[model samples]
Target chain A: MNRFASAITAFALAILAMGAAPVAAQQATPAVTLEGLVKLEKTIEENGKQKVVLEEPKVVVPGDKLLFTTRYRNAGTQPVDNFVVTNPVPDAVRVADESALREQVSVDGGKSWGRLADLTVKGEDGNPRPATATDITHIRWTVPVIAPGASGMVEYHAIVR
Target chain B: MKNARTPLVLGALAATAIGSTQASAAGVTAGTLIQNTASASYGSGSATTTVSSNTVTIRVDELLDVAVSALDAGSVTLADTAVLSYRVTNSGNGNEAFAINVSPTVSGNGFDAAVQTIAIDTNDNGIYEPGIDTVITNGGSTAELAPDAAARIFVIVALPGGTADASASQVRVTAQALTGSGTPGTSFAGQGQGGGDAVVGATTANANALGALLASSASVTLTKSFAILDPFGGAKPVPGATVTFTIQAAASGSGTVSDLRVTDVIPAGTTYVANSLTLEGAALSDAADSDAGTASASGIDVAIGALPGGNSRTVTFKTTIN
Candidate 1:
C-alpha cells in the first residue's frame, strides 16, 4: 500500500477505535465484561488469627450468610477510564455487613446508595432495625480506571430471609 | 496620491501570521446492559460490555416451630369420659407434621388422670365425634400443618370408678414436630418439604411441656349443734328457752360439689321464730333468693353455692320453746 494511503487507513482505524460509528462504539475493540457468583463464607483460625474465606455453598438455610461476587474484566484492546458496575441483591435477602470490597447499598432500587449501618428497615413491629444485609437492594463499586486486559472483583455477604 | 497608494498597498499586502488558543469540551455519557456489564470512557466515547451469569436461586429454608394448647377445664364424674382436648400449632415457616403422645403417668410436673385413650381430631373441629376422630396409637401421627396452623387432639380418660373423692388426676399431652427428624438443635441440609432445606425443631412429643388438670368429685358433710339463751338474760336451757341452732356444712376433699342443700326440721318442743335466719353471722331473709337459703313452715332450707373442697358454710336460726 502507498504511504499516503497507509496513513489515511491508520487514521480511519484510529477513528474506528474511538467507537465513532454512531451507536457502534459500545461493541468496539474488545469489551469490558462482568461475571457474578454466589458462595458461602467459612472462617478458620490460622496461627491464632481468624481467616475468613468464601467457599462454594452446597446448600444454605436460614441464619446462614452467603457471599456474592461480581468480577469485572477489561478485555478491550484500548485502555478505558472511569468504569461503573452495579449488582442487585435479590428479593428475600438481607445484606451481611462483612464485605471484601468497598461498596454502597441502594435501598430504593438502584436509584441511590448509602452505608449499610445508616440505612433502616421496617421490622415486624413497624420499627426500624438498622439496615443490615436484609435492607440492601443494590450494591455498587466504582473503578477509577480499567486498563486493557485488567480484571477486578467485588464481593459482599448477605443472608436469606 | 503616491503616498496614499503606497499605504493602501502596504495595508493590503501585509501578510502577518496569527496564533490561536484552545480549551476543552463539557459533557457526560451513560450506558447499561443485561445481567452484568461495564462501561468506561478514556478521553472520549466508550463501549459497554455485558455478560450473563446464571442466578443461583434457592428457596428459603423452612423453620419448624411447634406448640400445644389445652381445652377448657370442666367437671368429670367417676367412670365418665373426660375429653381432654389439645390443639397443636405449627408456628414455623414451613408445613410440618406432628406426632401426638398422651401419657397417663404423672411424674415431676403435677397430678394426672389415668389416660385411657388418646385421639386425634381428624377434621380439626375440636369435638370428639367418634367416627370422625381417630385414636392416636403408640406411634400416632397428625396431618401436616402449614405455618401458623393447628390440629386439635382429644384424650379420653375414664375416671376410675374407684377414684376417691378429693383426689385429682392430670392429663398431659405432648406433640413433636415430625417433619424433619433429629435431636433438637441439630440441623440438616435439604431434609424438608420439596427437598428444599430445614432445621429440626422440638423433638420432644410435649412441645408445649404443659399438662391439663382434672380433679375428682369433692365430699361435703353437714353438722348440727345448738346453744341456748335464757328467757331473761344469761345462757340457759329451760321452758321458754331461746335456742339458736347452728348448722355447719363443709367439703372435705379436692373437688367441688354444686347445688348443696341443707334442710333442718324445727324441733318438736320449740316454736320457730319468724325471720330468725342468719348465715355466716349475716342476716338472711326467709326466701330462697336471699343468701342462698330459705325458711318456710316445714323447716329451714339453705341452698349454699358450690362448695369447693376445703370450704365450709354456717347457717343459724333461732327457735323459742313454746
Candidate 2:
C-alpha cells in the first residue's frame, strides 16, 4: 500500500512539471518590435547676382524655329520607374521640327498620340489623309522608367503658324 | 477518488489560465515591428515664366487738303468748278480702302450748276468715263477711294462779275467718308462734323493798287445897299437953330469885301454951318464938314479881307441941317 501511494504522488508531480516547463519556455521567447518616424528639410537660394544683363527673352515669330526644354531631378530617396512628361503647344504656334523627339503629334490636345506623318482626319471628301504639321499643336514624351535621385531632359521644336 | 481527481483538475485549470494571461500581456505590449525604412522628400524648387509682346500703331501720314481761291463772273460759284487737290499715303502697316464725297451746304452756292459734269482721272486720261472715272452720285450717293490714293474734282462757278463789282468771292470746301469706308486720302475728309469751319481762307485782293481823285472848284459873290433919312422938313434957316440928317450904308455878299469908302457932297445953295461930322459911324471932330466953306467933306474908308459866304457889314453917318 505505502509504495503504491508514493508512486501515484510522483506521477502527478511529473505531469505538473511538464506543463510548467512549456509555459516557462513560452515566456522566455524574445518579442519582435516595429517603430516609424517622418522628417522634412527644405531650403532655397539665389542662382546668381549680376548688376545688368542683356537677354533676348523667348520670342515666337512667323517663320522662326521654336524650341522647348524640360529638366527634372529625382530629389527623393526612392528610385522612380516608368516616368513620363507631356507638353501642349500654344494654339497660335505650330509644330515645325517634328523629328526633334521620338515625336508623336496630338491634334486633340494630347487625348491620344500618333506619328507626325500618320495623324489624319476625314476631309470634306470623306477621305482619310495624313494631317499637316500645322494641325499638330501638342506633344508628349513617355520614358519607361527613371532611377532614384536621378534627372532626365526632353526637347522639341515648333514653328509659329 | 472523485475528490482526488477534482484537486488535480483544479490545479491544471489554474496553470492554463495563468499561462494565457501571460501570453496576452506579451502580445499587447509587443508594438509594431519594423523590417525596412523608406523616405521620400520633395523640394521647394522655383520656376520663373516670362512673356514678351510687340505692338505696331498706324496713323494718317498725309491727307487730301483742298481750298477755293475765289469766284468771279455773272454766274454763282459752283462746287464742281471749285477744284480741290489732295494727297493720300500708306501711313500704317496694312493697306486700307477709302471713299470720298462732296456735298453742297447751300444750293444758291451753285454747286450743281458749277459742277455740271464730274470727272475723276484715275488713269490721267483727262476724260470722263464710267468705270475709269466713277460717278458715285449716279449709283447710290456714295464714293469709293483706294488705299493711298489721291484725286481732284473741277467745278464751274457761274459768276456775275458784270452785274455787281467785278471782284472775286470765296467758296467753301468740305468732305466726308462714304458708308463702310475708311478716311479719305486727304486729311479734310469727315472734317467739321461738329458744325464748324473746316476750309482755310485764301485772299485774292492782297496785291491790288489804291484809288485817286480829280478836278474840284469854289465860287464867291458880293452886293451893297444904302439908306438916307432927314431929321427935319424944309425950314428957313435961323441963327443958332440945328437940324439932323442921317446916312447909312450896308455891304452884303458871298465874297470878301475890303477897302470900302463913303463920301457926302454938300449942295452949293446950302449955307455953310458946322457943329460936328461923323464918318462911317466914327466920330471925326478934326475933319472939316461940307456945310462949312472952311471944312472939307468928311469921309473915311474901311478895310476888310477874306469874308466867308453869307456875311454882311454896316456903316452910318449923321449931319445937322441949317
Candidate 3:
C-alpha cells in the first residue's frame, strides 16, 4: 500500500481508540458514588462537660463503641429516584442502637425489615423469641430522590462483639 | 452535632464504662480481620444501577490479663511444712506466659513464713508430687498458657518453731503476664499472637491472691494423785490401808492427739486390787479387754484414742498396801 493510504489508516485507528476511551470511562463511572467510613466514638470531658466525639479507629477491642457512616452523592446530570442504601453488620460486631430514625433492620439476612421489638428469632428451644440488637444482620435507609449535585449520609452505632 | 440522643445509648455507655473496670477475659481472637461494605441502588428512569462503597478493614489486637487464686485451706500446724496451693490463669485473648512471684511475708501477719520452694503441677494434678512436680524459683515464669487456661502451683513454706497457736500468716502469690504489663491500654507492637499489638487489660495484666495460714499445736497433759484410807476410815498411809489413785488426762491446743493412752505403774509396797479399775466413774474389768481401762498387778492402764483438744478424761483405781 502507498504511504498516504497507510497514514489515513493509522489516523482512523487513533480516532477509534480515542472514542473507545470516553465510552469506557462513562461506563466505569457510576451515577451515584458511595463511601463507607468507620470511626471510634469517644466520650471526653471538655470544659467539665461530657462531650461525644468521633475519631479514627486506630485501636478497637470488644465492647468498644463504633460509628459507621455511609455517604452518597449524585454524580450524574439528572436526578435519581428510589435511592436506597443497605449495609450488613460485620460478623464481629453488633448493632448498638435499634431506634435510630430513618433506618430499618433485618434479622433474617435482608428477607424482612422491621423494628427490633417486632422481630422474632427461633431460640435454642425452637421457640420464637424477640430479636435483640445483636440479632440485627442488616441496616437500610431509603430516600425518595437525590437531585443532581446533592449529597446525603446515613450512620449507625455498633459495638465489637 | 446535637447532644440530644436516645437513653439506651447513654445507658450502654454507662454500663460499658463500669464493665471496663473489670478485666475482660473473653472475646474474638487476636489479629482477626473484620471488613465491612455498603451497597447503594438507584433509578434515574427505567434503568436501575447499584454501586458498592470502599471496604473498611480492621484487625483485632490482643488483650493481656492474668489471675491467681489460692487453693490452700485456712490452717496449718506450727513447726510443720505448709504447702500453699494456687491456680494461675491466663485471662487474656492470646497465649501468654506468666511470671510467678510469692511474698512469704505480708503486713499484719502474726508470723512470717520461710518460703522453701515453689513448684508447678507439671502433670496437671491438684496434688503436689516431690519428684514429679517441676520446682520453680521465685520470680520464675511458667509455660505459655492459652486463653482461659490455668496452671496449678504449690508454694512450700515452713512455719517457724515456737510460733504461738492460732497465729496467722499471709502469703501473697502474684502472676504477671510475661509479654508486658502496665496501665490499662498499654500496647506492645508486634508482641501478641499472629504479630498483632498486645494491649494491657483492666487488670493491668497482673493479679494476686493471698493465702492464709493459721498455726495449730496439739498436746495432752496428765496429773495423778493418791488418797490413803486405813481400816478405821481415816486418810493415812499405813499397813493394810487402801490407796486410791486418781489420774486425769487433758488435751489442749487446736489439733487432735491420736491414740492417747495413760498408764501408771503400781507402787512397790502396794498389793494388787482386782476389779477396781474405773474410767470416768465407769467400772472396768480386771482383765485386758475391749473396755477403756484395765487393771493388772503390774499397773493400771487406760486407752483414750483420738483425744481432741479441749477435752479431758479421768481414770481411778484402788490398791491395798502390802
Candidate 4:
C-alpha cells in the first residue's frame, strides 16, 4: 500500500538524520495520554455587541458537551512506523463530531473501521441501514510514521446522553 | 550535528466547538459514572509496543420535575357528594416523593364544598373505591415514586346545604417534590438518587390544576279542571253536551325546565269538538301541525319548550258527550 511505503521512507529519513556511522538498532516506543473535559459557555454584552466565552466545568448535567483529546509522543531514539491510536466511545455519551485528523469509526466494537457514511448497522426494523453517530462504538487514527522525538494530538467532541 | 526535533503542545486550546442537544429525562441516569481510556500501538521492523492512557471518570447530576392534572368534568349537584379525581406524575430523572394538597374553598366562588376524604388509588386502578383505597391525611406526602411513574388520587367533598342552585365553586390540587423545589437550577446537595446533587428542572418541581362543581335542582307542576253545558243553555251532563277542560302548567327551580309538554286523552263516550283547542288565549288546529296545541285521534297535545324558573303556561279545549 502507498501508506506502508511512505512509513518505510520516513523510517529511512530518521536513520539518515541521526548519523551514518555503525549503531545498534533500538526498539521504537511512543508515550500516549488521553483526557476528558466539559465546556461551560457564557455570553456577555460588550460595546453594543454580544460575546461568548467558555469556562471549565464546575458541574456537568445531561445535554452537556464534552471533549476527548489523545496525545502521542515518540520518546525513543528510533523512528516508529505504522503508529495507530484507538479509542472506545464511552456508553454515557454519543459521538457528535469527527476529529481534525485522518479518522475512521467502527460500529462493531473496534473489529473494523471506515468512514461513518460507509458503515451500516442493524435497524429497529431488523434491516441493515446507514450507521449514525449513535452507532459508533470506537474511533481510530493510523499515522504512517512517527519520527524520533516527534509528537502530535487529536481530539473529538461528544454529547452527554 | 543534531537531528531535527518536533514538539506537540501539552494543553488543549481554550476554545471548543459545541453540538446538538438531547433531552435530560431521556439521557444518562443521575449519578451514573462514565469512564474512558485510550490505547496506542506502534512498531518498527520486527518489534511492536502498546501503551494505555489514564482513566477518566464523570458523574451525572439529578433533574427534578413533576406534573398534576384534574380528571373530573365541569360540575356536581347541590347538597350532594362530589368526587373529584386527579393524577400526579414524576417527570424527573430520579426516584422522588411528592406532597399533595387539595383545597376545597377557592377565591371568587359562590359556595365552598367541604372536603370529606382524600384517598390514593392503592391498586393502581383509575377508579376510587372507598373501603379498598388508602385514605391520605390532608396535605400528606406520597411514597417514593420512580421516574415517569404516576399516582391517581381522589378527593371526596360534600356541597353545603342551602347553597343556591346553579351556583358554582372551584377546587384546586397541587403536587410538589418532597426533597425541595424552587426556581430552575436550585440544588440540594447529596439529596438525589445515588447521592448526587438534585437540581430543579424547567417545571420548577411543582404543578397545580383546578376542577369545578355546580348546583342543580329543577321542577314543573300542572293542574286541571272541567265544566259542562247543554244545548238549551242549561248545565247538564247528557248526550251531545259540551264539556270545556282547562289546564295550567308551571315551572319552578333554579335549572332549566326543558321540553315541558301537556297531553290528555279524550274520555270514552266523548268526542273532541273540531277547531276548539286553545293555548294561552290562542286558537289551535285540530290536525297534528305546528301549533303548540294539537287535537289528534290519540289526545290533545301541547309543546312548551325551555320554561325558565317561575314561569307558567295555560291550555283549554272542548269535548262533546257522544
TM-score of chain B of each: 0.49, 0.24, 0.60, 0.58
Candidate 2 positional error at B252, Å: 88
Name the lDDT of candidate 3: 0.78
Error of 2 at B280 (Å): 97
DockQ (C-alpha based) per candidate is 0.13, 0.01, 0.21, 0.18
Global fold similarity of model 3 (TM-score): 0.68
Off by over 4 Å in 4: A1-30, A33-58, A97-103, A147-150, B1-25, B73-79, B105-112, B164-169, B217-322
How many angstroms is residue A138 displaced in model 2 relative to the true structure, after the best TM-score fit? 2.4
Which candidate has the highest lDDT of all? 3
Docking class of 4: incorrect
Off by over 4 Å in 1: A1-30, A42-53, A98-102, A116-133, B1-44, B59-65, B69-81, B109-111, B120-135, B164-170, B184-191, B201-208, B218-322
- On DockQ, the stronger of 2 and 4 is 4
Tell me the tens digit of each residue's lDDT in model 2 across B1-322.
0111112123322211111111110010011110111111121123111111111111111122222221222333221123322222211111122333333234333112222333444665544454666453411221233322334432223322111222233333333322222332212322321221112112110111111111111122323332333434334443323433444434333222333344445433333234244443454443434321123444323333333334443433323333
Judging by DockQ, tell me the better candidate of 1 and 3.
3
Q: What DockQ does candidate 4 score? A: 0.18
Candidate 1 lDDT by residue in tens digits, B191-296? 6554555665443323754444545667777898999888778777788889999999998766667778888999887888888988788877887673666887
Give stretches of model 2 more than 4 Å off: A1-55, B1-322
lDDT of 1 by residue, A1-161 (tens): 12443354356335534643544544544366667777767777999999987776654544556777777777766766656555565433455766512467666555667777667666657687675554455677677777778898867676644
TM-score of chain A of each: 0.66, 0.57, 0.79, 0.68
Clashing pairs in 4: A161-B28
lDDT of 3 by residue, A26-82 (tens): 557778999999899888899999998999887776667888889999988999999
